[model samples]
Target chain A: MEILSLNQISPDQVVLLQWGVVRITATLLYTWVVMAILILVAILVGRKATADTAISRWQNLLEVVVSSIREQIREISQDEPDHYTAFIGTLFLFIGLSNLLLIVPGYVAPTSSLTTTAALAVCVFFAVPIYGISKNGLAYFKEYFQPTFIFFPFHVMGEFTRTLALMIRLFGNIMSHDKVIAILLAVTPLFFPIVMHALGLLIGMVQAYIFSILAMVYIASVTQAHESHGRGP
Target chain B: MHIDWFVFAAQIINFLILVALLKYFLYDRIVKAMDARQAGIASRMEEAERLRQEAGRHLQEMEEKKRQLDARVQEILNQAVRDAGAEKERLLALANEEAQESRRRWKETLAREREAFYDRLRLTSGEIIFSTIRRILGDMADAALEEHVVDTFVGRIRGMDEQAQELLRRSLDDSRSEVTLVSAFELRPDQQEKILSALGPFLSHDVTLRCEVRPELISGIELVSQGYRLAWSVQRHLETLEEAFKEALREELPEVNLENAGGEDAPAQEGSRQPHQSG
Candidate 1:
């Protein structure tokens, strides 16, 4: 078994299976592993979950994680968490889990891949409009042409740039953390790599929070446009 | 730095699938359970509040009942006290009235006893004095005294007032029976004739003269004609003296006749002192 090296910029470059045009990369394999772990834990803990005050430790932990995510969503959006809890919670869970798993030997973090980060950013980009339209109907698109027609292209460009920034930010931070930790491991191969790996964990969790919060902000700007517009220039 | 489009699309699909799975298995169930638990807690709190209020009301009702019972007890006690006081007063009044009646009866008995003592004293003293005087007069009486008594009687008949003479005359005229002369001593025939001759001027018609001797006269002489009588007797003089002594005794000891002083006994006592006459 070959360990994933710092030289590989993304897990996507490592192909696990190959066909004519269907190449199953390490990114997809690791993503599937993370997904399976999340699903399996959810099923196991959720099945035994009770409304009673006495709950299993696993159920308690899961509730804490889910509720914390809901709270964060509520705070960022300044709205009820129910509408955004699923998408936002999944993003944080998947990214946070993937980043946390970086401590394992030979484990390829899916979020370290440009493809996964881009995919998550794209979801956020599309979800913002979907949530906005659900909340404000077709009027949500009118925000793009606000103030005058002269600022229309700029608003459109700002949307694409923000989406691109969301992708690049998560990808760059996680990839850089992995690279730095791998480089330090190679250079010192001792106590220093442990510290960097610990730092990497912190950076990874912070990135997950940042990514989810940014997505929420973007979605809230569209969904709560009237409130923002009412606040004035 | 190149993005794998297939991997990107697959990752997006994987995330969307995860979102759906988590939403179904985790978020919905947890939120529902929390809501159900909150609702149960709220209802339990409501029930507790209701029970507390009912208990408060029951406590208040009990206190009110206790207050009413206390008031009733006080009222009954007061009424009993009032009744006891009334009974005490009534008993006291009865006792007072009985004591007054007893005192009145005692005074009446004392007065009755005193009146009886005085009557006995008056009767005994009058009997003693009159019996003594009669004994003295009887011891002194003789034929010569009888002769003087007949002469005095004849003189009294001759010295009678006109009214007395007229009353004697009317009595003699109305008499169908004998006119009698009686003496304590034997009267001589001449002396008797002298007494009858002195009474002759008062006679309206010829009436029979009967001579009788009575020792109870005690050295005195008497003449009787139906409803009219003339007497000269030491017994009469003694009776007048007894009456005078009784008047003096009544003046000296007012209490002796205090019981009958102004009553029916007074007039009857006064009538007893009148001269002996029959209509």
Candidate 2:
């Protein structure tokens, strides 16, 4: 009745390029579609934004999303409400829009794939420490090994665990929500699919909030800890 | 599940692109709006504080002007009272002088009348004596004897009038003073009678007694006459000493502001000076 598994679409012949002991698989066409759709939405929203006149419908909706995300960012990043606004706001919008792609007929939700969530988590892992370092240079690194010399291992382990947690949480939630909706749709083409879709929207929003909140908390913990250590915010 | 390298690579590229686009475009503008809102709220709060300070300054100015006006009004009233008292004293002196002059004129008229009456009495006595002697011995030489008898009788009458005038002067002296005795003690009727009996020897005038119940005296009595107070109370002496100390402190520390007026940290007693007492 229904396909057992979802298949990945390839546009061209599978080509492998070897250069400098690096093998690169070219899936430019698939990635390009994802990029193009997101860019078109951004351009549409940006074009509708007005300095003087009332905001257009599409822009107004985007503004609400951006403002709500900005609020959470400020709350989580209590030490410097201004600092983490841009990063967390972008995280929320990208994740939200990516989750919304599941409602489309053909396109798979890009965030439901483990690669997408892991990549976002990796960015957060690097960005948080970089902000801490830039804000407080050598001292931020020293704080990771604080309390005692022996607690350094515990702190190091905490960092990896945080990254791993963020990665798994986002991946598990988004994929499960999408998979449940897909299963319900396969069963019936009736009123029940509507319920699953509504649930998907809810889960989509919650996942977006959770991901951005984790990013804010990570960045905030570093900066706040530095500040508590008598350093710059 | 096994990972597909192609799909994973594609997804990673897509994620980066999405982050880049959202960060560059959407987040920046949103943050700017939020910052603008925050700044607007902060400036508004500052404006409110400025307004409150301005209002406080204005209120202080108004209060200062009101105090000055009140002081000026009180000074004017005191000046008016002094002027009225001076005027009254001047009028009273003038009235006393007129009364003195009138009394001098009355005394002179009374002396003249008495002199005239004596002269007439001497003439009458002479006439009467001459008629009687002419009827009996028939001589005008008896007029000298009549004059001697009249002079002796007039001297006796003058002595009696002088004694009556001395008595009137003594009664006037007794009626001039108003004696009011204010006594404070927790004395029973029997104790009050005893105190009155003891005081009777000291007082020369008729005393009007006013007895008061004063629990604070503890064990002793107080007597107030005119502006003078004679108290046998330890509490009164202590209070007097306290007042003297306060006066000394006031002089030594003239700029040591009294606790209440506008100080927030003033003690309750310093702020509220109205004392409550029981009967």
The model with the greatest TM-score is: 1
**How many residue pairs clash in model 1?**
0
Please list all clashing residue pairs in model 1, or write none if there are none. none
| DockQ, model 2, C-alpha based | 0.14
List the candidates' TM-scores in order: 0.59, 0.46
lDDT of 1 by residue, B1-279 (tens): 899988888899999999999888878876666666678778888988998999999999999999999999999999999999999999999999999999999999999888778776775666576678878898998888888888888888888778777877887787886888878987888987888788788776777678888886678887777766777876556655666666876786765653443222121222222264221
lDDT of 2 by residue, B220-249 (tens): 344444433334433343344444544554
| Superposition-based RMSD of candidate 1 using all C-alpha atoms, in angstroms | 9.2
**Least well predicted 10-residue stretch by lDDT in candidate 2 chain A:** A3-12
Individual DockQ of the candidates? 0.52, 0.14
Scored by lDDT, the top model is: 1
Which DockQ-derived CAPRI band holds candidate 2? incorrect
Give candidates' CA RMSD values in order: 9.2, 38.7
Per-residue CA lDDT of candidate 2, range A159-225, in tens? 8999889988877887677677667777897999887877787888788888988888888888878
